[model samples]
Target: MSEMHELFLTCPKGLEGLLADEAGVLGLAEVRQSTSAIRGRASLETAYRLCLWSRLANRVLLVVSRFAMGNADELYQGVHAVDWADHLAPSGTLAVEFSGHGSGIDNTHFGALKVKDAIVDRLRSASGERPSIDKLNPDLRVHLRLDRGQAVLSLDLSGHSLHQRGYRLQQGAAPLKENLAAAILVRAGWPRIAAEGGALADPMCGVGTFLIEAAMMAADIAPNLARERWGFSAWLGHVPALWRKLHSEAQQRAEAGLTRPPLWIRGYEADPRLIQPARNNIERAGLSAWVKVYQGEVATFEPRPDQNQKGLVVCNPPYGQRLGDEASLLYLYQNLGERLRQGCLNWQAAVFTAAPDLGKRMGIRSHKQYAFWNGALACKLLLIDVVPTQFVTGERTERSHAHEHSDTGQGTAGEHPPAPAPAAPARLSEGGQMFYNRLQKNHRQLAKWARREQVECYRVYDADMPEYAVAVDLYRYWVHVQEYAAPRSIDPEKAQARLFDALAAIPQALGVDPRHVVVKRRERQGGTRQYERQGREGRFLEVSEGGVRLLVNLGDYLDTGLFLDHRPLRLRLQQEAAGKRFLNLFCYTGTATVHAAKGGARSSTSVDLSHTYLDWARRNLSLNGFSDKHRLEQGDGLAWLEENRETFDLIFVDPPTFSNSKRMEGVFDVQRDHVRLIDLAMARLAEGGVLYFSNNFRRFVLDASLLQRYQVEEISASTRPMDFARNDKIHRAWRITAR
Candidate 1:
């Protein structure tokens, strides 16, 4: 053993074997799988190679020292005892991470600090100069893991989080961690699947992590091809020539779109919440065409129109396996089973579920029970094969490969939920198409409310802009603005004329006045669909329809003043402000003030930190004939509210979820300083008066219990609009009255 180095690679819980396999591929000898990690012995070059190629590892570590670090003193002494000049110097940068211990030396930050002190002090005393810490992207990342009075220290060879594989330009909420994703693919026998060019399907593919990873493998693309940096590249004795060769080989494998053709991979989700994140990650992965996420449901999904090969349809669903209402989950799984059995016969199906009970409702005997863990919960993967007659398909071609070894178990085949399952009869109207009627039905229910809300929001639009642009002000809906290279066949002029006509015909469409319709336009830049990117690439502003409100800020973006998230807060103002004075601070375009005025407030004052918004507020008031009637002031909201000792019966306070307005005294964090803001706003509330405060932070917490100064009752229920029915608590809505 010519200079043996102790080392371990941290895997995300269940990816040990896969990570070990990757190391073995990279020429590491004596690679052994551990519980949530892997241990391997290799030369420094082997560690660097493994770092460059390992797809399922969080990070690869080169052990420096290990001891029973029970407290900070033990941690400091354990770290300081290492020879300082070996890998670190006063001029080099460093970073540290610690975990696994529940207390004592287990605190990640505390452990990290102590380790930092040890390294810096050791270097300072030896060389009279100390290396600095580079938290953003360190030259050296130190990891310390402790368990049951034992500690392990390793230098991270893999740079950044291995999850940033460089392929995703978009992501979904609670996205499958990259390590977890890799493990899922491996456990589903991706080696066998990849050899046969099988498809991966994610019915509830939040952000398309699994589909992207699988497609990357099928395309022979290097998962790290798009990544910018790696820890091995920053190693003291880093090999630039070897890294370049590895990178070039991976780059040569990258391809756009699906190489196998037809549909080898697909993902579907009903909630729009996952849409943007999914798009971002897909764009980042540069696999937009090979793997795409569609806004859809799984229950009635049909096979691809051009699928002629036997592919696998594997999915992770919201069977309360991780995040969802557990009670409503079993039925969803049953519906998924119905889709697989009735819609896909020539395909192999694998369902991964922590709730094996819910998996049983699929009513298909599992061929293999592969064990895994997502976070800490023990999970199982159930693979199945169905006979062609068991499927209800109107086929046009033959199966590419014969199913020789389905191995669907010989079991009782009737494990299900106790309560009667939902109507999952494997039948759908219109040739098994999804019930899109639900979306339309919800839109229908909110038609009246939408009309009213649009009217108030429109009060902020400039009415003097060009006809095409001004048409955007009258009504908010039925408007689409795109800045892109249009095909010759798609006439922009004709589209504009048609959209204008639609605006004029709004009354006929919805039995409401057409004058109430608002239409606006802005520019968009053409996107390289290879990245699934859809953004207005150039500068454009919300232009009024009739050249009345000539918004001159057309050099940057689309609809800057408006976001639909705060619709409920605006409604709350309109609901509770009758016969009361209202203060609309930070009033961008006086939309809230307009709603308050419309709700019959005695007086409404609109103030904003921006002179542009204040001017827009004046124009909006003039457009609605309230220019002189409404007090429009330009000032900092906090300062203005603080200086004036005035109280209102009704107050609407909705601030930017996060901002650092130099105009203000300090940076604002809604989560951390909500109480201070609320107290300040509530100071202006009169006795028995209602104060409506809301934020779209999604995770904002209001210490209402600590506010013995006021009686807080959630008014989010009262402000629920039809557009936000899917997720009512998308924002926290609360009403407080002086106790």
Candidate 2:
């Protein structure tokens, strides 16, 4: 027997056991599984076989040594102990991939640099030359992990992951990783189905990954046969004759397996440009004859006549990363479910998606679901049998279809036709009808103002009736409704019922689809909780306001990137900004600065405390083509004002009510800190300049002492727009000019 080595095989999360099973099936010894990796004892030939045959494994690593280390000095000593000559020559190029967190070694780059220094010092002493580092394609790749005080160093045997089967050269918008696709197939029980000669189909196959992978599995082809190079190809310890013999054995197996009857595999893609790439990848994988791809939509997809009776229908349809995407996907998913339930009667199906709620709209029940991660996104693979009984009834389908098609024709210039309203139940209370009537009255009054002023997003209703307590705002075709947290004395059940009534009344009275309405609770935020994400739907919509386009995220954050109450103030700044140097303090998303830029400001400066908001501000500026003469800095707003010597003719300061975020040195209270915040801002004001200060604290009171230093006028009444006429306390604005 040859020498035994400790080997570790890493895979995607949730596939650890499957990888271990693959290792055991390949005749390895002592297979064990962990959270995201598998361990076993194997000879050199066994490692080679696992790398070639195992489709789920990410990388095959050979463990060199493990020790206890805490800092950079200890890490250097530990890596220095490994023999340099045994792995590579002194002239060979190498790269170190370092990971893990430890005391005093918190950064990966510093740790990697230390590891590189130790290797070069050892090799330079032995052969009078040191290897150079190559990050892209290195001859030898070393991996080091540090946890607590323990370090495990290993060699990355697989160069660029075994999943890069060399077939997919071009990918679609959001392509699935190859290993993740393989894991999905394994969970779908593809191996067992192939053994029984069942066929396979992918209705929304992007670049033909699932279909090509399925064909290779049925033909018993090695997953990594088409790879151009491997880590061992450059190592000094590589055995050429042994690797050649194993390679020939795999070729013979693939050749004989191809002679047998192949399972019928088909792929359908909606994008025409993707069909050629899918076919090109299929040809590259040497599965051209067995796997076929065609350009077609999922609604009309059908199994071929020569295909087997019952197989697996697997697809990773578009799950919509943004708010707008989710509204459009309900119809696509419903169509897919209809096609499968009616056309492919006896087949089993697997739907992988990040939005399982959208998956539920498919009108089918999933008997089994497995959780998996596609990179950073946690996804699910749902298994269902395509039977008539699994689908929803006719009435439910009709309602779902109506919601899906309401957003059509909404992209035009003129008024869009309203979708037919659902019949109101007889049990609806008088308060609900009154709520509907108020929305209708509000829409009628605001329609003329919205069109004449060119404002698409405005407050329509603000708690008009005491019984219905919610605020509704219109952002073009979509509506956002925020319900205030009901008082504790109110019954939870009654409050919920009132809330449901308000949600139902919004769409019918406004002539908008229910799908266009989003509901959220308005609560007093603590610390930075208001800025935190409410959901992971990455949808952003473009809306017009004051003649400039701004991106509004209706799904992700509590605030839709724009404060509806400050609409008039932003327009005022735009009207007064020509030929002035402008400065925006606490610019949440740079909306004010964009307004100034569009109004022909000479130059503008924006400062904020959050990097996330700062990046958003940059995007907002660039979106309007405000390219030059605009600078955005991210830091403490007060500190920035104290350090800045530049003066501006116009400045806008809109601050949060209370903030105790970690990025700030001290807590901010609009009532307590307003004096100091304004004094510092005034020091940088240019001659004859005016500053507009605004806040959303409803009960705020301005200090009388500020009137003595500057001419202060409360313009809150004039600044409030007509949409907010019902609720005059939405925000307070002040105009202060140097006396």
Candidate 3:
């Protein structure tokens, strides 16, 4: 090797500039950047320093030879010309990585074999015995890049990609590679943020990649300090004394860095299973004291009051690229925007996502964007300065414009409310005025909280006014109103007047367009009556909950596609679904199955008797790109469980209160067959698996003696969403596990 060798530092695409900048900072000479590699001039010491310090570099390569070649013979001659004795001993083990091809060497394997033969032939001539080949862990690693009839051979100094930082013991779903995580931090300007005494946060921190990387950068810890082995460590030319001196200096610097006030860094995760792993990774990185993680939802995540202000909030939130994934992400992005706008004012925010379109839905326009690649998937890093100017107010959103005029065709109020005291019109009678006031009050009370939670479809008014006698739900830009049937004792004309007043007042009070609102009369439903069609509007509006998009049809059926009360339960299933074989029994519309699939379930089976709903379930699964791994079976839940031979890691059973459908062998009433239903579902549960059984019978009682063999806990309180807090009797749920 020459005194000053030409070296190349490879990194993920779109991170070339940061890698080059890091090389220049490390005092490498003549730094030049490309799409995925950075080239610079470096001595042996410079190369060693970068291997230990460059967080964005994948591997450090020291160029040995470059020659023009058009065929296998020329390639062999070129590699054979280098002095094999200086870099590798004849008795040592070696491996070669051949990439790119030109001339006659069109195959990587063939090219690698040719190069290996040439190296061995040359070494045999010099020492009389060739070196052995060890692909897994060789004493020396060589890389040969062939481009346009030219080949450049180099020695792999860092051994495995430098991105392996030697700390991560375990990882969660679709984890960001360590080097890419560091590159994201560099692009987000974390070093400068730390220098300015500003804190850092990741609301969706999974496995603490971002948090640990940020902490390491802030504390000036060497990226590869903890690595016990390196490619050069076994190389014959390595200088042990020099490496030991440099390693000692790094240790002293880290010790000094640790004494400074720890950076105000924290992370929050919705999945509890990931919290301990995050702490483990942090401890392995020797940064446990500087970083902290907690179990919490994004809706409630906030920076500590004592923490520094004006920092950077970086996160790689779930980017749904599958069929049904996009629709559900709308609310998550919306909620994220709200959290940043409300809590992190003045803090710079960086969100890395594969779907830039979804980022726009956050309502906070990104000031800058940098393209990147997470493996082969193209993505972007969006930067937004969370200042007052970018805040999204209620009036500026689509929901407000939707309510400009009442869709009822009656002359009602427009988008904005009228002056405080105007003459009551015939359309809005005295009773209508009261209903309007009540809706307006509810909207004011729930809108902010709902927005914070990314809840677009929620019950805004649940019979708040006795005269109204209706339940009102806001679904994005549309309103769904279900009026309770008036009692027979009341005068018919008076009841009709009150219903008209309530309908007219909704648009005026909610500021939603009257045309988007759908009205239905609440009635008792049994068997298949609830699924029956009510109108022919043929409109399917999309709303989001727990990062899943659901199709709701207020015009087609009395009940919309979603059961709003189960939002919390669906989210919980999403959290616990990873790597599990999930079974959804009585899966109405298969919304819960979609949640489980999105949560990383290996496979899902949704069983429902209604072919119409089974088809609906298929659509929901198809919407999320989970149609293939999941199945929608049209069969009776109990019968299917009794005949099934497969055991599930997780099972959910949510049966109707009463069903006398002809598809069933007999009437299946929850109150009469509760024990049988639980046992059937539990029978399919695998070891360590759980069965979530639920029904909305309101007064249903469990057969305690029958279920005594299983461990059961009623989770109705935790399963209820914030919107359903007013009515706990909406449903009953229990988590049952085999003893």
Candidate 4:
């Protein structure tokens, strides 16, 4: 019988079993799993096989000698006793690493220093020469791991970290460590997701790391497919023939497992800077053909209009807490909630964030929140239901603007802002399912009503989807209501096709030429834009209310470009815009910009942080021919107001529920900073100026004391438009004037 060789391997914590399993699968002998390690005896072939195939392990160590040691000195003696000259030439370079624990060793560095000293000492004594240390790329590597006073030293058969899988050619801003990424995927049960036809997505897919990794898993591709170097390449016992065979086998298996088109993987980012990086990384990972990266805003991001089946959306948004931008983060999350409720009802989502509280701002109770680490920061990956929101149907009247007075002297221009907001949309339901069911019923009823009454463009939902809280658009044609249902598959092409159908139908329904209807879709509101994609082309931006020709193209934003939920707010702005100096704060793309200008606003000022949105506001204004009269300011909403108190008869203050724009001196969270903001805006108020401060922070509270110097009128009811007349206040748009 052939002789068996003794070997030991090292892996990351919790991965020892995987290595042992690999060894056994490769037909090795006596495989065993230990803490951060795997040990076994095998022919040289088994060692090569383990090196080529094991995915979870870090290094495949070839055991040279095993012995007991009480302390560092004894450890040095055991290592020094090995015949170092036999394997490494006197001219070769060597490196040593130490890990694990021992009370006496004190530090891994000190322990490694001792090991290095012993190896050199032994080599010098035997061959009168010693190999030099080359930590960067050592020819012969040594690993010494000691735990609880026990020591195990082995030859590092794998040279570099196993995670340096050659697939990645470039990295983007803060690319995730490959090992950490694999850990995330494994933690999410990637293997299982792939098997069951489950999907994967990265909302802020900086460089497509997650996307490519997802594709690799779906294709059954080995994580090390792109790696050209292996520790065994330099090991004394390397078997090139065995490695070649193993490589061929992995290739064959991966190829056999690859899935066909309608690839269940996607990625998106609003910045163009990220688009190329994501593509380059995926291409390097050999997943470019299978995975794709799209450019758009988070607020406007949409899945292909046709794709309907739900998958998973995983994202790692910055921790707003570090910068106190929780409010904006909250706004972003609230919008995310809206998007999930509307667009991704059949999907599941996981958001990794350092602040769980920030995650709470999402307004959905996560099913599970897993803890993980990024660098040294503690983070949580919240697992959530990607369906519409379900709220208790009552107590929603808070955000309505009905209570405020809209007496902007001109009736064309509102008095100072309207009174504080009224209640929000009513929760009318319990589970998300119930909310969606009720909405579906409402849509059916509305469609029936529109048909029977022959009302063209009758409202489907006037207020926000408090019950199934998300953005939705319903239009009627020649008085026929158009239906935009989610596609049946997670296929992009199919989804695009469905979108095209909706796109074709919108023009006919809206009483506009087909060319005028810009077709767009959103993955989730306040997300990236699903612009004129390959499947559906053109802009879906024209809207009309009461023949007023309200220009809205949800395709232009993650936010439906219209905020149908905020219909009352726009109407309020419209009624007072004329003849008044209107100020729009956090003016996204400026639907408010357009409304204010066209409503007879004498001169309008729009402030926002995103240049992209500022440009969009410009477009909207120009489209309405209000560009000459309106001025768009590129600055932070809060900071701009702090310095520029230009009071007007009509002022709109809707700072993000939270914001972290660098240009701003500090973070602005509508919840904590509203009072100060209201004060500042009111200070500049032309005595009669009506300051309307609205925010989407669901639980935002007003500092009545802050407004004490002024007459605080509860104008929520008066401010809430007819569309928003149904129930609760999703926002608190108020009116304030000096007493």
Taken over the whole model, the C-alpha lDDT of each candidate is 0.61, 0.82, 0.81, 0.61
lDDT of 1 by residue, 337-421 (tens): 7667656666777787877766755646677777777776777878777554444332111112212221212111112101221
Candidates by lDDT, descending order: 2, 3, 4, 1
TM-score between candidate 4 and the true structure: 0.51
Superior candidate under TM-score, 1 versus 4: 4
Model 4, 584-700: lDDT tens per residue? 887876877677776888988888777866776777676666769688888876678777947777887777766555566666667778877777787777856787767766677
Model 3: residue 590 alpha-carbon error in angstroms: 15
Tens digits of per-residue lDDT for model 2 on 1-739? 9988888898888888878888898867898887788888999999889888889989999888898986788889999999978998889999999888885888999999999999888887454778999887888999887766898898888888888888999788898878888888888988899889888889898899999888988999999977868977898777888888888899999998889887878887777778888888999889888887776666556764443478999999887655334334554675577677756787889999887765665667888999998877899999988877776543212121223335332111112212222322112245656787788898999999899999989999988887677889988878897778888888876776686666645666676765577777778775677787788877888888988999998878878899988988999999999999999999999999999999999999999988988888898999999968999998877889888999999999998888888888889889988988888888888999989999988889998889899889999999999999988899999998898
| Model 1: per-residue Cα lDDT at residue 575 | 68
Residue range 1-739, candidate 3, lDDT tens digits: 6489899889999899888988998878999887689998988888889999999899999899999998999999999999988888888889999999779988999999999999998888543778999987898999999978889899999998898987888888889999999998888889899998888989888899999999988998998988877888888778888788888898888888889999888887777788788889999998989988876656455664453467889999897543223223544565577677767888999999987866765657788899999999999999999988875443222223334333322121112211122111123456666787788888898899898988888888887667678888988888887877777887866765676666656766777655455777776767777767666666787777788777877777878888888888888899999999999999989999999999999999999988878888888887877877898888988899889989999998889888888888988888888888787887788999988888888898888775669998989998887766778788999989998
State every prediction's TM-score relative to the real structure: 0.51, 0.60, 0.58, 0.51
The reply for model 2, stretches above 4 Å from the true place, is 125-127, 304-308, 392-739
lDDT minimum window of 10 residues, candidate 4: 408-417
In model 4, the Cα lDDT at residue 255 comes to 76
RMSD of each: 18.4, 10.4, 19.3, 15.3
